[model samples]
Target: MGIIWSVIFSGMSFYWAMGGRLGVRSLGGALYEMSLNPSPSFLAIVWLTGFIKLLGAALLIMLLVHRHNSKLDRKLFYTVKIAGAFLFLYGALNFITISLHAFNIVNYNLDHYATFWRLAFWEPYWMAGGIIYFLSAKRT
Candidate 1:
């Protein structure tokens, strides 16, 4: 389940990073539009971070698979825990930031459907997945 969630998260990040167009009216497209006004450095950093996150999630999944096949060692355990911690923090920070931004928009009477859905669902799903990873990492 963790692997599945990670794969989805990784794929979405990679898609956005690669400038793949979902549709002109899609949330991803909106993000791409938003990115256009930002400096190139900012866009580069965003892509870089997306790639880094994808790599991290992939590596974490591989590590877990390796541990499952072999005897779990202390080093592996700690590494997995660290990966889980990173996942949790990344998801949490994103969730909190988006949620806060959505609320701010609401205060100004700006109702963005995309932002609302993200606040209500997308971000929380990732954060919850991160929490699951953390809890699942504890014993294995």
Candidate 2:
């Protein structure tokens, strides 16, 4: 169970790293394209979010690589578990946003089936993995 939790956390960390990289790239491009008139607040938010994702990924990797025989490893596992819980909660919120957007339930423009597909199928597995990692890490 510990190994399984470690693997799941590691995998999620990798996924989040890649997602953060892509988001930074794409959002940067979009901000640039907006008449080169990027909002300072928007850019700041993007940078902050990207950094958090990168940091989370690094912490997860550190936790995964550290040997469990040490006290430090246990501490790292606790940190990873907290981070995993945050990630899963954030993912759940994202799914809720998607559902709201897709159903025209939010103030923004509806995305029709695009958001629906994401909320209905894709995000659950990631959320589940995070939950499993959190539970297993607690036991460890």
Model 2: per-residue Cα lDDT over 43-135, one tens digit each:
555446555545655655665564657788777778878766865787688678766766667744324443554565545645765676576
lDDT of 1 at 36: 48
Off by over 4 Å in 1: 23-34, 37-43, 65-72, 82-86, 89-111, 138-140
TM-score of decoy 1:
0.59
lDDT of 1 at 3: 65
lDDT of 1 by residue, 109-132 (tens): 224766666556666776677676
lDDT of predicted model 1: 0.60
**Which one wins on TM-score?**
1
Distance from true position, residue 75, model 2, in Å? 2.1
